[model samples]
Target: MSVWLPTAPCTPRDCAGHLGARRAPLPAAVLLTAGCALTLLGVACVPAVLLLGPAHRDRLIRGWAYAVVRAFGVRVRVTGVTAGEGRSPVGELVVANHVSWLDIPLVATVLPARMLAKSEIRTWPLLGPLAALGGTLFIERDRLRALPGAVRALAGALASGSRVAVFPQGSTWCGRSGGGRFRHAAFQAAVDAGAVVRPVRIRYLTAELHPAGAAAFVGEDPLAASLWRVVTAAGLTAEIRVLPPIPAGSEPDRRALARAAQSAVASDSANRPAESVHH
Candidate 1:
């Protein structure tokens, strides 16, 4: 079992001043053991899919993943999921604020969706296999040559009755302190596909589990320890607020639609802090 260290430089000022005391490193043995077990279990499910077909297998994998996270003590509470109404039957893109790496599994619990993942994730040891099985679409954000094909693939997925999830900010942040500006490529793809854009706001109610902006890999904060932090907090609530879906033609251009969606999420995040409900 390997214990991963935090990648971001933690100066005495950053850690000692604001963030709470740096506790002893978490128990790596338990964390890695559980991670390996879950990975193996996920791998085992691949062959079983031959008997269960693609759709059923996907649901099973998603359920298993969600259960694993919860079992590790990450209690995810969702609100405003009802905002997805009238956006179903496919042809829709769900754009949300990226907070933690946990957002992937958390979102999966609510929507049967495929994600637009960073291309580098395609090579992740255990996660890569599971993501491929779940039909995630990988894109190279820095490679302009690859953007066209990636957009086309996303558009096709939406048209074929698959809801695609994109974190338009293009990076993760600690939602409590706010986030960076969102990129508009995902919105452009939505427009091209004639898909409704569903803006979602994700909030991490707990402190310890909140992401440190510069962490290169999230594994540094052992998954179990972070999950425990979320679970045992006064109240554990990771909110997902899905705002009303904006129709493709509702705005004059993609940029306007993107701004509208961003504004919706920002407003929801502000007005409804306790309950992650979207208007």
Candidate 2:
């Protein structure tokens, strides 16, 4: 198929990425064939610390996340200064671009923040329990009435000095020119909690050093399928850039804050490559 060359995650936004439906499956199959031992090891070691508590569980999860991407042969490079030198923040909302399902583990690998996710994810086979153990806050997306309560919970968490990471985009994207729009709903929590919204940009690179569009779980993709594609994809890298926090107070309201924060992140990543890859 004809497509754009992704050279690396630093590729220009206008660049086109091929939808590798044909190319991803075979490598995914082969990777899975070799992934059994690693998978079993993780399952055996990681879950053992689940009942300990949120802090212990989150740290273990972080270690597991590191093991996971490495096990799958994926490298990660993080840039930008995180608030408080990477320690969790009290009144800060971490807003990031959602590129793929890998964003979750990838982010968690760096900072132990409470993530806001859809309620339905709680029903997914094992992910539900794992996310719960990780202290994830689930929002009832189907019930609009529950939104305020969810926001309230997020605000409460932030006020209580817990770091919260949310994907204002609501869904994943291919990390190309038009990744996706940032919805304003999630921003309310920041306003309510008087927290500054920190914008984070996440991008995926193919093993061949190109932007890996197929790594995104945008459409009707199953969890297993996305995982297979990511692990099987060669030389894949997850680059996360934590932009400076946009002060919510600077904006009049949540909507303006959301727009400003989104633009800030978009402009930062679009303007140039990351300052430098993390060591």
lDDT, each prediction: 0.63, 0.69
In model 2, the clashing pairs are 7-209, 207-234, 207-235
TM-score of 1: 0.74
> Please, what's the RMSD in Å of model 2?
6.9
lDDT tens digits by residue: candidate 1, 146-186: 87788799888887877889888776554544465667777
Q: 179 in model 2: Cα distance from truth in Å?
A: 2.7
What candidate 1 gets wrong by more than 4 Å, as runs, is: 1-32, 46-62, 82-87, 207-236, 273-279
How many angstroms is residue 35 displaced in model 1 relative to the true structure, after the best TM-score fit? 5.0
RMSD to the true structure for each prediction, in A, is: 6.7, 6.9
Poorest lDDT segment (10 consecutive residues) of candidate 1: 1-10
TM-score of each: 0.74, 0.79
lDDT of 1: 0.63
Candidate 2 Cα errors over 4 Å, as ranges:
1-61, 82-84, 273-275
